[model samples]
Target chain A: MKLGFLVDLNLCMGCKGCEVACKVENEVPLSSWRLRVKYIDIGTFPDSSRNFTPLRCNHCENAPCERICPVSALHYLENGIVNVDSARCIGCAGCMMACPYGAIYMDPETNTADKCTYCAHRIESGMMPACVVACPVEANIFGDIEDDSSYISRYIMEHQGGVQVRKPEKHTNPKHFYVGGGNQTLNPLAHQRIEGYGLFNNITHLKHVGDPHHGILDRFLAPFAAHKAVDNKSFMDFEQKKADSHDKSHENEGGH
Target chain B: MVEHGINATNAVVTMDAALPGIIWGWMITLNMWAKSIGTGVVLISAFLLYRHKKESMPSIRWIMPLISFVALNVFLLFTLVDLHQPLRMVNIFFHPHWTSAITVGAWMASLFTGLITLLLAIGLLDAYPDCARHNEIAKTVRANSELYEKFYPFVVFLAIPVTLYTAVIMAESSARELWQAPTELMQMLLAAFMAGSAALVMVSDKWSQEVRKDLALVLAMAVFFSFVMYMGEYFFSFKSAEAEVTLEYVHSGGEYNVQFWMAMVLGFIAPFFLAVSTMKSDNKTILRFAAILALIGLYLAKDVWLKIPQMLPLS
Candidate 1:
């Protein structure tokens, strides 16, 4: 059976109950985390919206981290769960570098690569993941996706139109799915400008979008941009109208 | 701003990506530098012997093997000490993975160390062949000098890959965009050769005009390659947003800008000019100054290379 996660962003309250539960269940170190909440602030000022996305290992079918491990420390179990055999790990940190999601962490205490295992031990005894059970608002859902009658499968089918996964361009075929919000929440790099300090006092900021200095070639290309500006406005207006029509069509379908 | 509503002032985007803790720090960098120098010395010494024949440079006949043996051991020692489980290092040999760069690197290092030790033993026996009359092992070692001379070129060939492997391991990491550049391997290889040659020039008491001139040329090539690699990364930007963010973090007046600029000026530009200016000079003091500067600059460059990439969050 292919196990999967269905996270509903609309239901997440940013209370971090899952984060606390995962730490308590797994006995994760004080400095490390198996699951964490990522707060994304979209737009600016009064027009802005905050999306609290719970981030963890997606357990991708085509996992880059598994392939890049120099030793067989990271491997896939039969149930599609990515397991880390800490006993065999040399703490080379290669898996940490290969993971696009940054799920794996080099645990200094254990001197091995550590990450979420989808609470494999609990699942073996026919129990839900600690994070899934502890979520107060029932935002986190996990079940065998292959079974059409399963909660995760039924929920995904019902909300199939709104479901999305992180970094679809990476072609990892992630088992974890998100409903509500869109690329702004799913794509880690979508927010071009952001500032914050993590729990560990690590600061995050945005990079310069373009080259600071314009060269002679830029000046030469400026006149063509003047012609395109007028056309760009009409093109955007047309796109807005098209989006309005699409929304209306979906509304009619829902009424029926 | 609406009262009680979350705004930019109150909002903070906290990232949960794996941050660079205390692992793979200065110790790893120093270990890599030492390994390159160790391998490089053996390769350069082999070239000198091949070119001038064993009898021509009588001083280097003893000096080269001794220095290389010591350096290789130091390299091996540092590598062992850096491991969290030093005893588990043997696991790399027993359960080897061909796809893993570290596994292959361990094998390469072992082979090079064995060859250098054998070569050094042969050198010591040949230097005092009179001792062979009294000792059986000395006789066997003296007899094997010619055999090892033939094997010396093969060891030198292995040295080149060993030097390149150090950089290849880092470049293989797909997530760190700064380390993923093709030029990184080339840059490290050239820097190793330069550091090795410069270090040799510093320690050697006597240097012939032709030997000095040849080293000057090697130094120039190293500087040129450094410039090419730096420019390649600067101009031909990687398409990913993560790559751009990392590039800007390191290059565009971020915290690492000072260190990056220092590395560029001192490591590449200063050494390039110094080596060029002292090319025709017979003054040993002037040459040593240039050599020392090259070593310092190269070390600083390596420091910046290892540290700056981790500053950017991968996720």
Candidate 2:
């Protein structure tokens, strides 16, 4: 009984209903996400398209988080859902390092590691995940992938070779699948990221807040080498120059 | 203000970013650095005891466990403080999961500390039996030289695992391609040797010149191999794209460029030269200075190595 999740990129309209539903159902705190929609723009201007990729835990068959966890806080249920026992978690963040997909987050309130469980709580009560129920276009398909008659299993069959999973080379064997999204949409490195564009723009330091050595570390490292914050100018400047040149080429062509 | 919407001109507008900032930070770096010293001292002291029994036995017995005990405590303290749920650490021992490197490391480290504590007691009692003249157990332990010998080997054996287990934990980390288990394990071993020898150099004031030369040689060899491993990885990390990307943090003009080079020069280059010089000159001051620099540089190198891989966006 392998539970799975499938997102049809073609059907998703970036409504953000599922994102809201997940937070509400799970009571996720601010600045954290159990599930998220990534908006990646593909191609150049005049031929560009936007892809809404709903990202969440893959609940891998060989989950690294489950293995790296010091206390078995992350364990696989009989139904294949990777569940978390916050009570048992020592909050080592070892799971955070082990999860390739970046699905896990340190819950600010509980001070424990947390992530998408495919809504195991609801599933046990015989209810679908809130994201599935909230999605207006029915883009989210959830069911037993092992059961041939299941909707998710049938969807996988229909899509066949077209289905894609992120970072398959990592060999996590993610249960989450995507249909109709190309490499540009699935691969984060394939696209250009602008500074000050996303959540907490230019605030990559938010990650440091969780460290006990936050302020002291800054002071301690200050004398040694004085490493600057991540150089956003390197990549962002290159991207902006390319975009400007692209616009110039388009204008020159139009003038002709 | 550029919002979460696509501009059609730009390549992407990532609406929701899941970039967890440096999950493990300086505390973790300190943990590894201290552990290396703790384990390295035991390993080196054991070798010295076996090889230079006459010169090293009296001092090394008490000093080795004492140094290790202090450093190991610092390692354990930071490890606890770094955890978001420090109180639940007992779950590691109470509800033991043998698979997790962290759980295994915790148990091994605890047992290692315990053994070191026992060794310290025995060494102190053996060296100064008058301190515990009234205590029967202390007197009994002081007389039992065979028991001390038996326990010493166990501490030596346990030190290797306690030092190497962190590499397994790092290697097991998902998507962190930089921390390959084999390479990391090798690096950890080298770090132990480097740290152990450097630490012994600091306390070898009462030891013979030959023993000092031996410690210097060990420091030089460890530094040489450790430097070679770092350079190899830095130059040849292109085999894996993820590893290449992670190495970008230390590449020329990259974020950690200056610090990485600083670590190389201080930890390996200077130490190597000074250690080699001490072999011929028998200069205690230069040897001690080299040891100090090596320890400091090791901490910096570890800090950079740990922080760089995490800087790469996992999302």
What digit string (tens of lDDT, one per residue) describes model 1 on residues B80-198? Answer: 65554445566677666566677788888889888878888887777776765778777777867796768778888888888877677776565566676466778767777777777
Give the best candidate by TM-score: 2
Clashes of each: 0, 2
Top of the candidates by DockQ: 2
Clashing pairs in 1: none
In angstroms, the error of model 1 at A58 is 2.8
lDDT score of residue A241 within candidate 1? 58
Which parts of model 1 are misplaced by more than 4 Å? A144-163, A168-173, A181-183, A191-256, B1-18, B21-23, B46-51, B128-139, B235-238
Where does model 1 sit among the CAPRI classes?
incorrect
True-vs-predicted CA distance for residue B47, candidate 2, Å: 1.6
Which candidate tops lDDT? 2
